[model samples]
Target: MQAWQAGAHPRSAPGLADLPFALGVASGTPSHQGVVLWTRLAVVDPLDPRVHTVRWELAEDEGFQRIVQRGQTETQQALGHAVHVELQGLPADRWFHYRFMVGDAVSPVGRTRTLPAPDSPAGRLRLAFASCQRWEHGYYAAWRHAAAQSLDLVVFLGDYIYEYASPRSGLAPQAATPIHRVHELRRAVSLADYRDRYALHKSDPDLQAAHAACPWLLTWDDHEVENDYAGLQGREGASAEFMAQRAAAYQAFYENMPLPASVLVQGLQGLNQADALRLYQRHAFGRLARFHVLDDRQYRAVQACRNPSESSAGTVRPSRCAELRDPSRSLLGAAQEQWLAQGLAQDSRPGGPRWTVLAQQTLFSPRHYGGASAAAQADEPTPTDPWDGYPGARQRLLHSLQATPPRNTVLIGGDIHQNYVCRVHADPDRPDSPVLASEFCGTSISSHSGATLERAQALQKNNPHVLLANPEQRGYALVELNPQRWQTTLMAVDQPGRADSALRPLARFVVEDGRAGPQRES
Candidate 1:
């Protein structure tokens, strides 16, 4: 065991005052055996190849008197000076506090916990899932409020950082609240640009607090690289240059996040992130809930019926786009589709989890829009960016699901920048389609929905399975999973630009045991 004063500075190194741990420390991807600890070394010359030593300590109590784990690790410049310490053999289902030290300065103390032993009977699990946090739109008050809650884990669905240039440059939604601040650099292209972007976003105190509060299981969406990228194909079209940019972005993403080393690997071509991390993996919280994290960005074909630069990319009339219904298109790709099918079958067995959570970016349930009349909607097509665009892929999973349909499967999603609670049927349009799943789509933490509130609310009428929809609010969802039932309360922030905003619960939905859908609690 190492002994030293909690805040003692044995040696003061140069450039340390510039904030060595500028991005802060975090922990995540925890299991019954252990958890991963993360931190980035911010220096004047970020690309320096010299290795820097960082000391870390974990304890049962907030103070150092109860130190449980202590060690020192060196972060080489080649990996962007990011340290990911995978600590194993820790006791399960217990809270732990950790901090990092360089010279005398210390990083904020973070709290994290490992899951209960797999298959062990669980009592209650508090999980808060959110996504789509555009840096320029609003303050991260949502994160500040969420940190104060009693949460076991935080699942960030995607869009951890937007790759586009700052909204102040007039690229953001026009109706959004005025920018509270600006980003560090232009659209992220090189590795340095991406690293600076992550640093800019992490600089937020509220976001830092949220990471320090608990561990997070994260996946990416379009904005992390670029909006609506399809595999190697970018919005501008696929090319060697674009792939190189993607490689840099992927490496930068892995450097900033608390993902395990299993997710980061260099292939013959370059960094193959999707292949390495195997994002479509499952985790069980004892017997209470099973979280299946998905990557909707990789392996999917390009958006059909519309181009990226078009103004109406997200909306189109079905009659005008025959290719939208092509049977060859896919969203989750082929291999993941098969993997999910097997997982669903295994989970549907007689003794399965009480709740199966499908955590991913973008919406799953279909949404049609055109006019007030069903005939008018029949004239329109749903956005291709979400499952609505890939009916064939959606049908494939829905078919497999309708066959066995995992126990109490509940879909939690972000992106679309709105809150929606709906029932998922094999065919969203059919009057008598069997409801196979339940979906709870939370709004963005700060990103604005370009559509007006009335336009978003009007969607509820076009889609009957929708019990509730709100586009005006900005915040996240609070979900509690137990053996008996699962409850999700939609929490919204009244002021998106205000850092001191409170998270007021807008609505609550409950999924009963053995039921296939969620019902309005009120």
Candidate 2:
């Protein structure tokens, strides 16, 4: 923690106008002991250079009559006046209410909870996972619904904010409903641009309510920095300018999110050195579940056989591109892959977590988007941005799962703006291969998908492993886990453009203990 000095506060400074907490508050990265509390001081001028002291208090009750913890922290213009208070040595598996104060202004009270003790026999865990919430596409109705779910944790898969200039700038056409909002900048490139963009997204009341509901565990996808970005490379390829832009985006992301101070320090050091941010992490919910939150965009190799003419992912037949099958290519990079394998192996051991949850970005199962049959589609032109493009890396991940005991494993992901529920086979190419795990790839919160319901239904015949595919709806996945079984409810909002839209369960499935495929429950 950085030492704070007693100085003239923003409220006391002349000519400086005090503002309410427009960006709101959030908490995340929970452990048995404590969690990371976050808030950014809303100022009249974001570029105000004076360091301001922000005070916070945590209590067992919402009224905060009996405050248990109280402290003060300093924020400055360098970090967008954001404060990350990582508290430790607190009781485990308990709810706490916290709020930040600057002079007479008090931030909204946020509710957060710590994870169960590592050795405790936790009975159940309720979580909701979502992704791809393009602010322009629709209202945050899904988030509002999620806020009412009373989830213990919210696993955000990615694309919390899109980098597109406008709805028209996206690759696909807008949904039937018109865009409800627009981005502040044409495109977020500089630190100020990214900061303003984050501020815009954070201003959503529904999103703020969701953040205040519980602690969030997040791992971002491409749009957080740039669409289809891989490692240090962007859509137009790598350059000094792109690297600097990436650094700014990363810094802004760290400042806005409810992440630990350690991540901020490491991210800054990495930005200065390698233009990267270490985001992949593991969290345990007692011995009931272990979440392996993965970062797929930061260290992945550039998409295979990328077309020089296009500014995004390329589609090519596997037979024509040998690079697509190259074993040297990786999505999680060598180090993260190794770390994942080790964690999965350990979690599969006796006395380890009963359920191993691999929370990542994008669909994991193989899907055929073209050709008449699955066999023919295997050779047809396929997008080089997903798991299909990195067959070798996907195979390695399967091998890692195979090496572990037959524990209850669930793979949850987002991206592609579609809901995909499938049985992850040991080898997707082999129809007779053994089922290794169950997967639930959630639909985007609001991002539009080009594939219609009819098209998604038609593709299911070619992809037998898929149990459910709904591309038209826009919502999230609610997961409930216990020792006996794991349940996932596909929750969709009736209208993405309407703020008061009602949410309904599109589908529900369950995976029994020792089973690897999802069975339709309703």
Candidate 3:
């Protein structure tokens, strides 16, 4: 049979080589015995099929000398020359190491684990989620730290790659460098550009180690396509041709990431044609935690930054803003809103998990950081790119949480590149009002840090509901859960630019039973 033919093994063919270690072997969306293992073959030439039959072996030990499960799968350029092996018959809540093979070549081994069985005795689960790792700004020291700490999973909440071109003049001293190559100081255009972009960032050993460490649940934000791109409406004039180009970019994104077959085979024409996008999914960690990953950019309404001349210092009323007040405007869109509402409601039903986690991008809190007097100060204005920009939708979600609040609904977010701990109040103005839920916004893993220490003081003075806000920090959040309380620790790296980046505990928080918010824990 020909190499392209189904069930054809490449061992008999000439010039066949094992997958490159650059792609790395990793898994996602873990189940009891079945999990997804992924890898991308390096291409020296695009015309040649690069067709190879890869053998995957999983074992309980780091050294697969004692293999438990083994399988072989065919790979072709059609799927970006990527191999995704779904292994079954594995035990629950157990660690497994796997490797890929082709002809005489062997791929790097990776570690992965499966979720505990449903209704299994409640056990401890450790998960770390992060976002906004701009390549130009800093290094991925945080990801390295996360890999060192043994965790069950890592949820990447978007801005995985920036859509902007690098500054013509080098970045400011404190700024990050762009990961993708640029021409004419414009965003990337072709698939090769996007592919090379991922190649640049993925070259980071820390990020690769994190993927090798555990299963990753990922979703995209605006930067993956275009800045603040909402459907076909781009922030800076998304023409039809540009939209088509954006579609190409999205397809390239799928080709590069370690996504599943279900997600990879979504549409017919190619992986990029609607069918390959896997933005949202739910993962139940036994009966302890339920994570609802979301896709905000695809369904969200295009955002418009508020005019600086129209507001005050402490409380800028954004209700007059067209994008903010558009009731039809949605951050999660109607479909995703329904999905979230249904998930929230289900978590409260008997037999559901204790914590209903929203693994999403961007802050869900309503905060006007523009400082009330923008109208008089004539500053540019507040970037209405967050939940603060979609008040109606925010209100809708808030009301949903308040009406039938889940047992423990905590929203984990990223994208703004800051750490925020706030009590999600149904009414922020009402100090004594019952808090509906709590939000633990993780700072960027290695993105730019804001003036967190300084902003903490201003936020305290302006927003009372926010228990703590750290605008200056490059770190990740570790969320520990139990039936009674949820403990979260903000772990920050001492210096990302330095080679030996040391991490330390920046802060800790805990939410007691029945409380709608978190408190800084001693």
lDDT of 3 at 439: 90
Best-to-worst ranking by lDDT:
2, 1, 3
Residue 143 lDDT in model 3? Answer: 85
Candidate 1 lDDT over 398-503, as tens digits, reads 8888898787889999988999999988777773688888999999999888767787777887778888878888899999878888899999998887888877
lDDT digits (tens) for residues 203-271 of candidate 3: 567888889999988888877775666655532443555667676777766766667657644552543
Candidate 1 residue runs with Cα over 4 Å from true position: 1-12, 15-17, 168-177, 234-238, 265-269, 272-277, 306-313, 371-374
| Superior candidate under TM-score, 1 versus 2 | 2
Question: Better model by lDDT, 2 or 3?
Answer: 2
After superposition, candidate 2 runs with Cα above 4 Å error: 1-18, 167-177, 234-238, 265-269, 370-375
Worst 10 residues of 2 by lDDT: 1-10
Question: TM-score for each prediction?
Answer: 0.92, 0.94, 0.87
Local distance difference test, each candidate: 0.81, 0.85, 0.72
- Distance from true location, Cα of 177 in model 1, Å: 4.8
